[model samples]
Target: MTDRDRRNLLERRQRAAAEFVAWSDHHAQEQRHHEVLLAQLETHPDQLDGRNAMAQQRAWAQRDQHRRHLHDSALAQLRHAFR
Candidate 1:
């Protein structure tokens, strides 16, 4: 590759890396939020108003699945950066 092409590729990779870091941080926050919600639902059932335990659990599961999808997408982006 030409020097200019190489430079552009490197810049793109750097940008992708930075973006992956930010995405990972956001994923971590989501995980923490999920954990907090799960704990509250499990530990303080009475405080959840009329929400049923099964419904609360299902909601958390759905959020967790979405987080996993985000994580997979972030990892794919990071992998593409190396290519």
Candidate 2:
């Protein structure tokens, strides 16, 4: 292959590697967030009652939505890396 082609291939490989790292980091952070939430619920079981439960549900739903968005972005990045 020509020098230019080799350089392009190297660049693409670098991009894919970077994307993999980014996705791994995002996944780790998401796991941490879940761990923290679980700890909170465990420590304060009373907060899961009645009105508080509804509020917690809404908050969790919002958080889950944001997390899903981030997860999708990560997936897209990884897909681009392979392409």
**Cα miss at 17, model 1 (Å)?**
1.1
Q: Per-residue lDDT tens digits of candidate 1, residues 1-83?
A: 99998998999899888988898799889989998987878687486465577778788889989988888988888888778
In angstroms, what RMSD does candidate 1 have relative to the true structure?
2.5
| Candidate 1: residue 57 Cα off by (Å) | 0.9
Query: Candidate 2's residue-wise lDDT over 1-83, tens digit each?
Result: 99998888789888878877887787788778878876766676786377776666677778878878887887777677566
Q: What is the lDDT of residue 78 in candidate 1?
A: 81
| Collision count for each candidate, in order | 0, 0
Q: TM-scores across all candidates?
A: 0.79, 0.68
Off by over 4 Å in 2: 45-48
Candidate 1 wrongly placed segments (more than 4 Å): 47-51
lDDT on C-alpha atoms for all candidate structures: 0.84, 0.76
